[model samples]
Target chain A: MTFTINAEISQFQGKLYKLSHESTSTKTPMDVNVFVPPSSNSKIPVLVYLSGLTCTPNNATEKSFLQYFATKYGFAVVFPDTSPRGAKIEGEDDSWDFGTGAGFYVDATTDPWSKNYNMYSYVHDELPKALAKEFLQLDFENISITGHSMGGFGALSGFLKNPGKYRSVSAFAPISNPSTCQWGEKNFTNYLGNNKEDWYKYDPTHLIADYKHENQPKILIHQGSKDGFYYKDHQLQPEIFVKAAEESGYKGGVDLRVAEGYDHSYFFISSFIEDHAKHHAKYLGLIE
Target chain B: MTFTINAEISQFQGKLYKLSHESTSTKTPMDVNVFVPPSSNSKIPVLVYLSGLTCTPNNATEKSFLQYFATKYGFAVVFPDTSPRGAKIEGEDDSWDFGTGAGFYVDATTDPWSKNYNMYSYVHDELPKALAKEFLQLDFENISITGHSMGGFGALSGFLKNPGKYRSVSAFAPISNPSTCQWGEKNFTNYLGNNKEDWYKYDPTHLIADYKHENQPKILIHQGSKDGFYYKDHQLQPEIFVKAAEESGYKGGVDLRVAEGYDHSYFFISSFIEDHAKHHAKYLGLIE
Candidate 1:
């Protein structure tokens, strides 16, 4: 998986490298942006950020205000595209939420989607391996994972499913119980062949209920109080995951903070990015 | 001069208000975004930002990273659109560099353009007056001005032409000697006719040559060393303006800092936004 440097932009005391590489899992060319902090002599810790729906690598790279924090903590941040591009499947570009830009971080079991919608294995398995082999300056072993919305679900599920793979995990307005949410129900049914059992494997609440951490693993989450998805539709049932965690082996490990007056936008993510960066920095050992 | 609130977003400790208003100067509806700091009992000082060509109010509002600084300094930042929209001129929107987004902050004196290209008066006079009347909390009287590229030229010319209007002025990769540059020459010829005297009135170098600042006026500027415009094309000759200031009435007033390995993109602006914010904060009396 040889990566091509699309652009190397000077941002803060670092360089934002936009890279594209052919993926084995999705069997398509994937675009990812990595921000490498300046004045680094050795391999640095990495933070993989999965973006939400309808986003390319450029959305979070431009709006998340993560470069400042990445430079401050000497950590590299990788922003992967939400889904595969130019895949001319029958219903790929049908809707904004269903196919294109909505990979849902799942290895699809169904026919049409199974061919290309392997984002879970792509992001968790193929991407890190490719990045580690390509960029020698990034320490993929000491990495933290985070995301927003559907990508938030990706981070939580990825961290939970592959324990000990990521040192720390956090999310911004993640869909906690994807098995029950409308967005999850639609994508899972299409991607996983309407199998509830397969959907539960990817749900954060169900995964956390069975999985246990050796050192009482802590997961950080921030949900906006005024988020339209949280309040108006009640699709993101964060409290359900909190309740499930409290009753399971991962009891008292979830730290869910509801920020006041923030909506589901990058404006909300940027305001609280400092805290999230510090949280990851502490676990990544960049800060005491 | 009636204003309509397009959107109000909470960012950091301020509210970013996207507004559209009918402009008397341009005789068109203009879009502007204002970030007002939180918990201000009295009117707060304003920092007006003029964007470069090919930018609307949304560019800086989303990418400039100025809201954090606005909240930190307790000052309101105003981002005004670069040019009038949907005017339907013969050659408007023909080229990205010339027509629709390239008002050049000048009130056109020619036949076709004179009908709507009145950005100078719109930004300097009409916008502030309307904002003051509508939002009584913004102290337009005590304001600072800054911009990037062509907008940088706008800030310098606007400040120099109207003495005592702005408390401080700064620019990033500004087209300083607009009369001598291709971009400046083209816009000046179209907006103000081919009169060299009219072009001189809007040129920062010529304006600063004669105008005497009362309080040892310090104009801060940051030009990227690797900026393609500055190095390759030699279009943004910032040094000429520096030399002009050194020999003119504004001697010792211009502080032009050349940043190493930076480009003329928002990445450069976001990198040094904190310093620019602090500079404006000092002159706005928000910080010592």
Candidate 2:
């Protein structure tokens, strides 16, 4: 069945389009929201934004700083739900870590979740195909992928694992060495089973250490100095990935920005969003 | 009783201070949200944003195209809720145009509302006083006011009545001749009684026609050509106010800009907000 999109304008000075679609791969319907640039022209570049754990499509659509950039660069933004929802299947009601809100942006192979939790294919394929059919101005060819925390891990793993899929990639305080972090350790162990190699494939730091992507895109990483979860003192060390980028000869070497007196909040994301937009805009050739 | 405030950071890249104030004037506590510029010093000029009908402090704080301007011009923004909430007093549950959500930015003189509907005093004096005590850097001496629809009316009426108060003023599709619009008629009749004389005191066009300020601050007006409420054919015309400003011999002339293909939504506000902030910044000496 086709999704009906509700069109409305926000006081934020942007167009809000809400649509729902049945995923062929996931076997479950998903809700998605897209914010197009203020421009009347429809063929604008797009940014695929993934959200973190305990978040749905509504989180980033309602809170992220991508719109201002989209409004400025005349780009469109597509936000997909973290996992398939509304089904009464088994294990869907489990803890917040490995269940509904945590699709891990990968195609699940196990039961219960495997029935509908194919977020990787949903975000990369189904939604884009639906968006292009509905909106005339969306440029799928110049799309970039980005997210925060778990979503950041998804973006890094998804982009590195499939090098030519996205124009560029970046994240804010993502689980860099996810295989080593507790949150990542728990999720990876469940989602991919006890396969350590499968875990490294989704780990950004591990990908950096191994080195992939002959045509590397600019990577912008923004981390708050005061972020309680992954500060320099915390278990989630971003520098290890920075070091990995240095040693592995990664293309478009990391531009790690340390924001002072900031934390792991949208305020931190919004503060440096313009820089990320500019980075993507430059690589996508949307702006000079 | 004192209101409690907690400082939280927004993903929009700014510091958010949530304020709850005991409105001594009304005996009912009020909740307001403020977003400050990315400046270390608090001595920045302030812009008091008044939202339209059916809105709260959260609307502008969450949506407005303010961050770009706030960051660029280094101005703090104070967003007060449209009206007082919680008490189930008489007429409080009236239509959407009056009572609870629609404070009209005026002090209700009649029954039921008079006790808690003192938005005029709250915005003009108490809110600023609270912000001043809490945020040290806000320069009240160099403050400006702006809004949308009813809030726009509030800005114009507030600035016009309190001449020499704001260095500048502007609005997005304001109800210029509110004395005749349906929204104004409904709000003013209930809040100000059936007396046209009382309504004139809150009407911008009427206020400007009665008394002119010598150093009239730069008044920037942006009205969409396709505004659903105030098109060229409608009663909510911007021309009447523009003509009144021109013929009334006001010192500071109005800068009326008609945006093509825009409406009364935030998309219109976001598109031109930076320009408005720049206008205020130039007069307040925040940016060269």
Candidate 3:
């Protein structure tokens, strides 16, 4: 891994590393921020955070209190960029929700996008291994995953696609049933190319019923009741995903929490970040 | 206070109100963010935070964890802009420091700047009264002040000049002796019109010596040892401020803590914000 350290910043009782590296998956330089807490006797657990649409690694790395909680829980956090930046595609910088800053965490099988939009392989497979090699004190096997909005969809899809890969998973106002949302449809049609089956494979709502695990771990999710994306535009259909989870063999696995008076912003994320951190901490065995 | 609520976002158990109002002090539409915690029997004490140069209310409001501490301590936090924005004078938006964001918290006496650069009066006087009217539950009498860098200078100058106005005061990497530093000298010269005597009035180190107070409250301050502004450029002369406080009979009143390995950013501020908030909470009788 040809990794370059952009800047190392201190926050809470930890150091946040702004890093970029050449990726084999996407064949482009990727930026990822990793925060490691003060060392302990045991190797620190890792929690990979995927950011929402129109966000970069710096958004969650700077705006949210993830570092504080990671330090408190004695864990490390990895903030990956929303998409492959500076890819130089023809119309990549057009829409806020589609091309730039919205990879949607799917391996694009379609033309043009297939070259640089391999975020699924980059995030789920390559990034973790690269981070582990750099930070020997990090326990990659005890890693968990979480995200917000578009990143939330990435987290849920990533967790379901590869069962037992992550110790646990959680999301904050994720696009639960993206197969049914307009935001998902535009990206899926262009990235996956007309195959509803290909979209179903990446959709958490549809994939939940097909995914098989011997011991189904509880999936924690927080959906804001006042989220405009969930209520007005219907961009997030968490209820449909919850119902699908119940219909699947993994009964009572999805723990959906509807938070009142919250929105789809970092304010909502920071508010319940303590709960999300604690949830991952329990599975990672950082807390009793 | 003709206040217009721009946006109200929820964080922790409180709502962060992004407000812009026609200012009686700056004579421009001023922006400020107020986060009021969940109400209790006791009226909430206010913590007015002054931001550094090149910052608006959103920089500190969105980046820092002041809202979390405020909710935890049951107090309200007011984040006022560094200066009156959109003044549109010649060279107002030229440099990142001198004119636009770097108000230096001084009531300007020079041409062009004097019309709108009245942050000293805006933050110290009119802001409090205006905020008090808008937020009825806030206990203005028990309010304390805090800031980062330039705002740090503001907190100290305001506290010293006004004497019994604020219950307590603290700073993070403040430009202590602004009459000496480059950032201070440039702003002071242009804003105060080459009048060294007038500049001393706004300089915290100089004001500490002449101001007469019945009881000197301990002013808490944290200066990062690794801060380039402090170590290399000598922009923040905290040690000079401490020595002046002692000579002026405020012995042991200025608690100057030089924190190791920290920088002059929100990273440093967020790490020690709990301590600053607690310091004010103690004076406000929130904790024993």
lDDT of each: 0.90, 0.78, 0.89
**Model 1, residue B220: C-alpha shift (Å):** 1.6
Q: Which residue pairs overlap in candidate 1's backbone?
A: none
Chain B TM-score for all candidates, comma-separated = 0.98, 0.94, 0.97
The clash tally of candidate 3 reads 0
**Candidate 1 lDDT score at position A133:** 87
Query: What is model 1's DockQ versus the real complex?
Result: 0.77
lDDT of 3 by residue, A1-288 (tens): 368999888778678889999988887899999998986736889999999999989999878898889988898999999889888988999999997899999999988999999999999999999888889899998989999999999999999899889888899999988878899999999899887988999999998998787646688899888899999999988889888888886743888888888899888999989999999999899998
Q: What digit string (tens of lDDT, one per residue) describes model 2 on residues A1-288?
A: 277675554423567677777788678778788887667765688887788888877766655557878777777887778887776777666788777788888776656566677787888877888778777668887788888877877887777877787889888877788788788777777667787888787688888777566768768888887888886535456788888888988878888887777788666776777888788887777888
Task: For candidate 3, write residues B58-128 as lDDT tens digits.
Answer: 99998878888998888899999998888888888889888888888889999988989999899988988
Q: Using alpha carbons, what is the TM-score of model 2?
A: 0.88
Candidate 1 chain B least-lDDT 10 residues: B208-217
Residue B40 deviation, candidate 3, in Å? 1.9
Task: Please tell me how candidate 2 rates in CAPRI terms.
Answer: acceptable
- Model 1, span B97-195: residue lDDT tens: 787999999999998999999999999999999999988988999999999999999999999999999999999999999999889888899889988
lDDT of 2 by residue, B87-165 (tens): 6787777678778778988988877777888889888888887678767778888899899888998999898988888
- Runs in model 3 with CA error above 4 Å? A249-252
Rate residue A29 of model 3 by lDDT.
90
Give interface RMSD for all predictions. Answer: 0.8, 4.5, 0.9
Off by over 4 Å in 1: A249-252, B249-252
